[model samples]
Target: MDEHESGAAASGASGRLARYVVAATLVRSADGGAVVAIVLLAHASGQPDWASGLLGASITAPHLLGPFIARRLDTARDGRKIIAASALIHGTFLGVAGLMLPVTWAVVPALLLILSGMFGPMLTGGVSSRLPSIVGRSQKSQRRAQSWDVASYGISGTLGPAAVAWIAATSSPLVATLALATAAIAGAGAVLALPRQSPLHDPGTVPSPAHTLGSIWRFGPLRRTLGLTVIVAFSVAVLPIYAVAVAPSLGDAALAGTLVAGYGVGSLTGSAVLMAWPLRGDSDKLTSVLAAVVAAALLLVIATPNFTTALLAFGAAGIANSLFFAATLAARSEYAPLETRGQVFIWVGALKIAAGSAGTAVAGTLISGASWLPVAIVAALSAAAATVCLIQRSKGRT
Candidate 1:
């Protein structure tokens, strides 16, 4: 291509990148906010805590079926179209949820919301798989792309709940639910804006979802990456407890929220660093080092007596967690075969959600019985397990 054509191409890709970031951030922020809003709405309607729990489960439980949905997406003519359709349908469900007021149509709303879960994986995994297309084969460009994606996802996870709380407090929980429905539609519009591309999978080579799952189960590097991801997910899940332990010494329990917020900020910083100086190393080695750092950071948090030290440690842990997340994604994208990429990304996401759920339950239980010390030990053990997996990957055992 001539200089002018090359310049134009670069400009076009840059614009698309910006759009991708905005759409992803909005969709994820809405997801985070909507999850909390669902529980809040359920409670406001006089439902028990179990009912709230059920509502939360309706959203995440569909992740288990992600491989199946991803397999279908892989076989479709236009992945973007599928993703857009799913987002639109999900938005419709969220709108129906907003209308199910007065608490009488609770069961109907729950089922509709549960069905909505089916589209989430498709939307997220589809976007992720398209990253390679957007950034091309250059390692630095790809790293920047992934970092942008990771940073946006992490930030959204933090901001989404806060947004929900603000909207619910300032207005009403019903309005917050309705807002998520609107956000979902907006995300659909973003997906529709992308330029058309061919399918990511070969039609004849596509396997059953069961076969895809089995392949991922047996693949060594992918397995190790998933294991490391679980560790990172669990580490994040325990942040609230970490905040609780540190906030009292700072003269206000509210200060503990800063610890949680610090982690989010740290993730943004890490992503920025990666974008500026992309890592061109083995993801296995990177995962191992980052996991060890996170473990040490958690241990430090447990030992630090002052709130300042604890806050710093948590922030460091968050930075390492973000880098670790990027490494895991790189490992999968580097090694996962073309036909199985969608399924792998889908399963990885599912496992992370499951790990986060487990971490929350474990952290809550352990902290109740033994405080943050035992929780730290549990977190350290998870990190250690991830380290072992990374080591195995390095040894060519994966």
Candidate 2:
């Protein structure tokens, strides 16, 4: 292509990526915020705590079927429509659930929300899976877009919870829920702006779903990358729990909220750094090193002599965790085979939600023991995950 044509292509890719990033960020913001808002709403509504628990579970539980949902998306002529549909569905149910919680609808709210979450992948990794086709598959184009895309996750994570809490505090949990629905609706509109892409992958080459799960093992980079993601997800699931647990020792029980906020800010910082300077060199090595950083940082949180030091450690852990995730995203984009890429991304996202849910359960049990107990376990998990990745890397070289 001539220089002018090359420049035009670059410009078009940039415009498309910009829209995708916004839609992804807003959609995810609503998704995570809804999870938090419902629990708060249930508590405020004076229903049994289990009512809120059920509401949250209803949202995440459907993600387990992501592989199947993603297969249908893979075969669809335009995946963007599915993405837009998911956002609309999520927003619609979320708004209705907010209204139903304080009224007589009762268990029906969870049932309705479940219908929306069945399309959950389209809100997350399903959106990400389109980045290569949307942004152009060239190394430079893909890397830049991947960095921006992962950074959007950090932005959404931090924004979602913070917005929900602020609105819930100033207004009401019901209001916060309604606001999240609006964000999802806006995100759906932005998603429709994304260029329609025919499934870039070949369906004929895909194997049975059982072997697809096994395929992660055969792909060295994808295996290590996603394995680390699961371990990190587990540790992060314990993050708020341990943050709250450690607060009393720091001399103020109120530090719990501050420490969690610190971690979120640190995560945004790390993601911003990568967006500014996109990752280079061997990604596996970078991921392993980041995993060790996360472990050491948590250990520092455990061993610190002062609250200030402990707070810094929390920030450090957050930074490493986000950086590690960005590397994971790049790995998935680079290594996941073309045929089953959609299903792979979607399944990986579901596995993360499952691991995180399990981790939250285990952390809750262990958190009440000693303040140091849960943090120590999280650190150990990070360390162990790194070791496994290093071993796999060595084997891959052979």
- Among these predicted structures, which one has the highest lDDT? 2
List ranges where model 2 is wrong by over 4 Å. 1-7, 200-204
Tens-place lDDT per residue, model 2, 194-271, is 988766556666666567778886777777777787887888778788878878878998998888888888888887
Q: Report the error of model 1 at residue 139, Å.
A: 1.1
| Number of backbone collisions per candidate | 0, 0
Q: After superposition, how far is residue 185 of candidate 2 from its true place, in Å?
A: 2.5
Error of 2 at 86 (Å): 1.6
Model 1: per-residue lDDT, tens digit, 1-398?
99999899888888888888777776766666667888898888887889888887787777666667777667777767777777788778876875784456678778877777766666565567766766667777777788888877776777778877889999988888888878878988897777665675457798887887778768787777777777777777887775775577667889888888877778878888777777678776777777777777677767766777777777877787788888877877887778767777877887787788888777777775545765577567767776687667668885
lDDT of each: 0.75, 0.82
Candidate 2 is scored at a TM of 0.93
Cα lDDT for residue 112, candidate 1: 78
- Please list the residue runs of candidate 1 whose C-alpha ends up more than 4 Å from where it truly belongs after superposition: none
What TM-score does each of the candidates earn? Answer: 0.93, 0.93
